[model samples]
Target: MANTTSAKKAVRKIARRTAVNKSRRSRVRNFVRKVEEAIASGDKAAAETAFRAAQPELMRAATKGVLHRNTASRKVSRLAQRVKAVGA
Candidate 1:
């Protein structure tokens, strides 16, 4: 539906960006899942380690515009809380 040349190019760029963003989002999810799985298995050390790995990934996704900053901060805070609770 892009009739103009510029419009066509814009569409192409959007497609490429979408693919990249999708990949980034999936990667973030996998990192979060690792922490969740570790928590579910009740391994405090493993959960802590996974959380450590996930925290930066979450923030990085935010920095890359894949996630909102507040959303990433909230997720990190909640995950850290859960990881800490694993020891209690």
Candidate 2:
């Protein structure tokens, strides 16, 4: 119900932003999932590699405003710990 022209334009912008954010969020989740799957498979080297890939994706998501900085950092820290534990 955007009656004003500016309001309509704003709605359109929001829709586009929503789609982009959705894709970004999905990409982040997929990256995290890859790391988790590698960890679950008990392949230390593969898990480490996946973690390396995921860490940057998580931070990039935060930089793009898809995730909070602390949240991203926390996830990276926890995943790193899990990856480390895999070898031990």
Candidate 3:
């Protein structure tokens, strides 16, 4: 238990931040899933569009510290590759 008033406030802030981060992470995952589903469906145009939509979201996640820079880069690379493969 947080005995100090400041400590309690810090815990509340942490809880709020956790919810915000979780929402952001979930949103990113949904965007990635959309790209993957488009790829799996073999819709080249849809996959490309989904990839385009996902790129900025992934980059934003990195910028917001929701994801590591390399992780976001790797995800973008992989998604782009899948998009290209389908579009080919």
Candidate 4:
């Protein structure tokens, strides 16, 4: 129900951005899940590997605006601590 062409274009852009953001968010969540699963399984090496893999994804989510930087850092920090404890 956008009367102006600019508004119509904004709606279209938002729709496209939403789809992209959804995919990014899903991918980040998947990485986080993988790390958590590895930790739950008590595989220290696997957990470390998964954490390593997830770090970049989480940071990317923050850098790309899908996640807040502090939130992403907190998640990474917690995940790293968990991995360290498991590895220790």
TM-score for model 4?
0.97
Kindly indicate the candidate among 2 and 3 with the higher lDDT: 2
Worst 10 residues of 1 by lDDT: 79-88
Residue pairs with clashing backbones, model 3: none
Q: In model 4, state the lDDT of residue 54.
A: 100
* Model 3 TM-score, all chains together: 0.96
- Candidate 3 structure quality by residue, lDDT tens digits, 1-88: 9999999999999999999999999999999999999999999999988889999999999999999999999999988987899867
TM-score of each: 0.98, 0.98, 0.96, 0.97
Q: Of the candidates numbered 1 and 4, which has the greater lDDT value?
A: 1
Clashes of 3: 0
Which sections of candidate 3 miss by over 4 Å?
Answer: none
Candidate 2 local Cα displacement, residue 88, angstroms: 0.3
Candidate 3 lDDT at 77 equals 99
Alpha carbon RMSD to native, model 2? 0.4
Q: Which stretches of candidate 2 lie over 4 Å from their true place?
A: none
Clashes of each: 0, 0, 0, 0
